[model samples]
Target: MISMQIRRLTMLLFVFVFAGCASQKSIVADKRLEEKIDQNFSDAAAQYKGMMRRLPADRFPKTYYAQTDKFQTGASSDWCSGFYPGTLLYLYEQTKDQSLLLESERILKVLEKEKNNKTTHDLGFMMYCSFGNAERIQPKPAFKDILLTSARSLASRFNPKVGCIKSWDKVKSYHGGEWSYPVIIDNMMNLELLFYASKVTGDSSFRNMAISHARKTAQNHVRPDYSSYHVVNYDPETGAVKSRETHQGFSDNSTWSRGEAWGIYGFTMVYRESGEKSFLKTAEGMADFFLAHLPKDTIPDWDFNVNQSGYTPQWKYDPSKFAEIPKDASAAAVAASALIELSQYTNKKQSKKYLKAAEDILWALSSPKYKAATGENGNFILKHSTGSVPAYSEIDVPLTYADYYFVEAMKRYKELKK
Candidate 1:
């Protein structure tokens, strides 16, 4: 990891020197958007630099948590491939920061390795962060193989019988009923890999699979209110929806905050890429449900249905009995970024309302209760995160993806500045 950082920092320096010749005239004019972007990019770049500066000179084998002393320890890389690299690209586009580019490239290499592993359920989180973003931000013939390989790997996971990519293979040992195989909320982001692969390979099957999974989720996983379940059980052989379950939150019937956030963003992205009215309408519906239930500031508790007042009967509250209910600012930030994207795609006043909801969430994140201070144990920008719903782990800790989304939302605001 240190080597990766060093290589990235070096590349950034080179990019800085190379980008020095580019013009730096005012590219954006809306002051509010401009300020948000500037602050977000500043914070993101600082954190990336901080990670590089704090690392020890001695190299160590790169386990997930190996460089704890160097970077924030809470879920550093779990959901960060998209947030990290996406933020780096944002910074690069804004400041032409050579160091950021190098940093992005270094992280991209790490992403490529993970993409090749294919044992995990987060193909969207893994491949999108590395190759999907690489193609958009730093397109090159050399990166094509990495992107294609990653895309193919993700595409291959599409179970035709199920019409969705299976997630949670790592947890196959978990004692669950027969209705376990189906698409997950997190799989929404991974669909881009299938779409990209379709475009790359000229294979409509990949595109069809992506759409099929999304359509199925829309029908089964998302409730009439647009709030979504974490998991939708499927018949492995027939792609039929058997039931909806929540694995990482209060209960199978409860709404996991992050799961709803994923639906808001994921469905919105589907609309953007596919130009499907149904996707856009579903995105709007989901966003509406999420924003409606959010606190005044737009941040939400870890589980929307966790019965914050704790008045529900014990049997009805089976899951929360074992775990403390907490707020998840990371989910708010990610949802905010997605809403901002949706705002750009739509001209309706409702789109603007969604954008304001995201901004409100960002404001909440910047507050002392949510945002982390310098040199703190948590290197991430936001505080009070939850990694595992069942274990009740990482509560009130800073998360890398939280920081990443905060930065990404700010960047989106900046890009939209008139």
Candidate 2:
């Protein structure tokens, strides 16, 4: 009887171990996931159609305030202008909707002039997202020239002394251009354009600039715990650090959620391009930090400083704001898209972990709690995205980039599942 009991106990233990291993390998999903993705794509088509009808001849949609029923638009020079056409291209790619294509082409015409506009550091956001996707889908020679010009324009912002791309010429809060040679965390997101330029033209200059920027950013912008500051101002002439501040976060020391998300996407892309283990490690660290902070719903607050101590607020400290801190679905969407790419560069176990986290976020954002109803939300897809809480801009609104990354994540998730 003792021998028989031992055999049964051993068999049960083996079964339990096998089950645990199997579950770890599996991504979080269900029958409803695909249905949710498809429904989102369909809703995107109709929503964008409504946006195009109202989009000014030379303007791009930025955000929509549902409470005020306001649709904010900006010129092609606006940093967010590329996201408008980019989101439309993504929708067109998924749905093959000709209207989305037409609108993207029309918007691209307005945005194309920025290829030669060298005054701003947002050329990548304004040109690449608009024309890069165009080149991928259509592959025209004109698109190549446009992208090359945009890349050159972007590379112009790189200062060898600083070993980073200058993020802004003017940051009034930081005394722009005088004491502030601002290098923002978001600038890392622009390196893909440079890498593309180097690939097409066989120009090591562009690639070198991107590598330098990534390396310097990894050194200065990223924190020890893998979280990041929003902006780092450097002395352009002396190549010395000035100050690190979070202009749009609650505190200067706080990890603004979107800025952190940018770091994850940027480092992941850098690793993919350079195949350097250091970049991969950096990306993984950033991803891990982001994953650790996610709430039960898989979304995050505008800044990770809400409840944490040791944070010094730029404004008056207010405990009440933490009671119901606004959530940033945009940041969650961006991280989801980035984590999918980051997963490809990790080991089997870590890859599964990253992909599962991404899956959970995608699942939550696709639900009705975050996604807006079709034809509502000023025709934007996801709702409850916070742009900059400290700046008091686009708070709790539908952002164009939020929709862009969400759709990109859906496409990536579906492809990975297949």
Candidate 3:
């Protein structure tokens, strides 16, 4: 790990240099919508504070089902462990609530041990979301140490032969088939941690691994339309492509909304970090593809091809139930946050298009259609996120990460307007 002083300097340099250059002067803010966004943040502050009060000491919030009034908790090892604290940090950043900060700090101490966890590739989702934001807001030597260690742990999952990070080791009977050396599109999101490792430690190994992984995913995981497959199994021994499948989407060929969102965000971030024109173009293609597929309300179904003619779901749903298919606000939240950053990397015309798409999403999320009531949703802010539809789990629920990225997008929106 690099020294904390050097790491801090590196982070500062990255923020100044790679942060996008979209001109926000022409970006006009809608007063009524702005007020609504403010209220959403304010409500999120209270909702999370109330949640922290009721939360178990050792558990992290995952998803909440309002219909059943069931608030679910996951262990510290769960991929979602970071979003609770991450959301708290965002709320605290906007509201300056001591309660939020104290809660976030409390969770971070428990979550710090995962810095050494090597079993999962979600350290970015689990560590960077919490510790990354923590370091940004309240930089500390300990935070730096934790982040670097987490980066190392995440790097351990990369198999050089595969040219990508392994998403799941092997799984049998998972979503109707077996997977070996699977490299899901979601894995692209984890590359940010590797980039951070290289930037601070000045180690090209981490950067090279990240570049290789990004290139491989951009080449294989995308369809002709730039829509992403949920999973792409690879040959670990020869670095050859085996098959592409979907674990969470409607079908193997269908586009899972969150998976596509991850690619868009990941490529945009990779572009920012590496200054690779190819990654930027890839991100722009992905953003355009995702935007072109949005529903009338700008939210996305759990999978984009759920009802398309050529795509059939792995699980059978009644034909009458087609209209009731759950939408994924989590996907929207993630994509909106990414689009805000992606906007900075483009020309004025394309920037406006990306920003407009993001604005539409943010506006919809702030409305009653997707935003939860102030104190409802078990103190969770947004509702209607589909976690894993094929698993029949957390469908149409309020997810912690959804709340994390919603506020994150709102924060970016506020800053962009300023």
Q: Which residue pairs show backbone clashes in model 1?
A: 12-98, 12-99, 16-98, 124-190, 384-396
What lDDT would candidate 3 get against the real structure? 0.88
214-313 per-residue lDDT for model 1 (tens digits): 9988988888888787877787887777766666766666778888888888888788778899998898888888887887666888878776554232
Q: Residue 323 CA error for candidate 3 (Å)?
A: 5.8
Ranking of predictions according to lDDT: 3, 2, 1
Candidate number with greatest TM-score: 2
Better candidate by lDDT, 1 or 2: 2
Ranking by TM-score: 2, 3, 1
In candidate 3, which residue ranges exceed 4 Å CA deviation?
Answer: 1-29, 173-177, 315-323
Residue ranges of candidate 2 with Cα displaced over 4 Å: 1-31, 174-179, 316-323
For model 3, the run of ten residues with the poorest summed lDDT = 19-28
TM-scores, all models, native as reference:
0.80, 0.93, 0.91
lDDT (10s digit) by residue, model 3, range 1-418: 4699899999998876655332332324555557878888898998998898879999999988767777899999999999999999999998998989999999999898999999898999999989999999999988988999998898898899988888876564345557778888988888888888888899999999999999999999987789888888888899888888878888888889999999999999999999999999999998998999899999999888887899876665555744588999999999999999999889899998998888889999988878877678888888899998777788888998899889999999888877
lDDT of each: 0.68, 0.88, 0.88
